[model samples]
Target: MKLKTALLASVLTSAAFAAQAQEVNVMSWGGSYAKSQVEAYHKPFTAEFGIKVNSIDADNPATPIKAQVEAGNVSVDVADVEFSDAVRLCDEGLLEPIDQSMLPAAPDGTPAADDFIEGALQDCAVANIVWSTVVSYNSKNVSGTPTTIADFFDTAKFPGKRGLRKSAKATLEMALMGDGVPAGEVYDMLDTDEGVDRAFAVLDRIKGDIVWWEAGAQPPQLLADGEVVMSTAYNGRIFNAAVAENQPLVVMWDGQILDFDLFVIPKGAPNLENAKKFIAFSTGTKPLADQASWISYGPARKSSGALVGLYSDGKTQMAPHMPTAAANLENALVNNFEFWVDKDAELNERFNAWLAN
Candidate 1:
């Protein structure tokens, strides 16, 4: 009787441990982006490993990650963050370091280090997608086609309210580009006081016409509802609205700001090992390519490019729609994370002051 009781107690304890080990919490930017990750990464991961994934959303995952880590109550096992935030958070020691060797090799047996695109792997982050912030307009509302970046600033030509993100980062870059600063020269120009003034001066032209959006989901809704005719938006949101929901939206590739979204483990994640496993499985070549089918964002791995084909709708080809496509690259600007990492606080202070005035 004593031996049977001990055996029952041990079985119950082991079952509890197994149940606890089979779940992970992932935080990400909400809206269509989150949906894409759920479809491509989460569903497959859960099926393959028999682990439960809890999907959490925020306007920006970075904010909650910082808050949680600093408060010493980290709940998120993994988070999808922008390149600058990843670098900044890693530098501040708020994230766990990810070794490159843990990532899976390509299908052809090429190592992960060689398969990933340049700058995709970092000390504490592994990139999943290369997304872009582009200018998009509701076709039914706009007067004529606004092809160039400068057209976005010219109210006289477009003649409707513009939706601009309520942040200093992309807003300033687009303003400089609208004022005719070339893509390659944008960062160098923004590095100066005079250049900063120039960008703000251009923004002042359309200040009254601007409708500010802080979340990725807002831009598409703003355009669809005619709240704003033209908006600077994440390309994937625009694509989803246009293709999936059958909205009359058009993306202007010119002046698009390309950047990467990476997955990182918080400093003290409750399921650290499971988080690492999720990252490895999700970032593999097939999974990366699978994400592109759900959204127009390019895969971070070079090996995944060839595998990216039609969209989920079964007809739309994805390559030409990608931000990295040759045609789209004509006047595109790759985001300078280093510049933003150093200048984000100072510029945002000035931007807030300007907003008040």
Candidate 2:
């Protein structure tokens, strides 16, 4: 279940070097998941296209991506952009707008431009997978279990220390839900200033009991090590961590925040064509399912959805973030990245200021 970067690099070098090293640089959020995608899918792709891919880690960083693009030092030919960042990149003229004819098209003749799942399309990028920041509790520590964000925040209802992510985008949406907003209304609420403040107010109630985690990796690790009894976590990270020990953790789809990872080309990318090819190839169902098997991502490919139907033991074979698994949740969140992208600047500032307080 643990992703080994060294081993993956060795395998990829052998496989890809034997094929293509014409070399295109990709700035993705490098880590186990990104590595696996490279070693598994990208390596084979290079073999076919004779194009080498250099993956650089451009994880959710402190500085804005627009700054990097503006500086003309755009190091990434292909980037694994967050939808929110992609929007900002597009607005700033820091993204290479994709041409549908140049990319893969769906069976119905719609180009890859429209192949993305509903609520996932944007002006600058394509969502590659879906995930959630949801209630994950160590079964070993708690009496029963928390079923939703409300339960996680309900200290009197379920007494224990809880974990919340440090980001404002998803956190604010979760807060809005806790404040009694319906899952579907989250984006609509964020469209108004009053709703944003109202969501923050909801967070203030449980702020004392909540410990903050900054990345997808932290919350699951904390859960596995018994650091926090219960907290919110990326569905895949927690599920992947559980592969070894079968940790007593669960993701309640109820009011769960829908999140995703996207792929984009930075402004002034040299290998724009190659980047498009890589994206189209990687986004196909089988490669996506390859990620789903070990990585626990909710595949964005329509074919990945069809492919999952072939697996019988959905619980045993799929992680909670999988479309099959998430289908069972009572409540689910739909993240409107377009909204976050537009508001990330102001929202992130206020979020940081609030966290500091």
Among these predicted structures, which one has the highest TM-score?
1
Give the Å error, residue 104, model 1: 0.8
Off by over 4 Å in 2: 1-21, 61-65, 106-115, 119-121, 309-315, 319-326
Q: After superposition, how far is residue 293 of candidate 2 from its true place, in Å?
A: 1.9
What is the Cα-based lDDT of residue 223 in candidate 2? Answer: 77
Q: Per-residue lDDT for 17 in model 1?
A: 95
Candidate 1: residue pairs that collide: none
Question: Model 1, range 309-332, lDDT digits (tens) per residue?
Answer: 999999999999999999999999
**Tens-digit lDDT track of model 2 for 294-355:** 56667776656655422222446664446336364567776787687678889989888888
As for candidate 2, its clashing pairs are: 139-248, 253-331, 254-331, 255-331
Task: Quote the positional error of residue 277 for candidate 1 in Å.
Answer: 0.5
Give the CA lDDT, 0 to 100, for residue 5 in model 1. 96
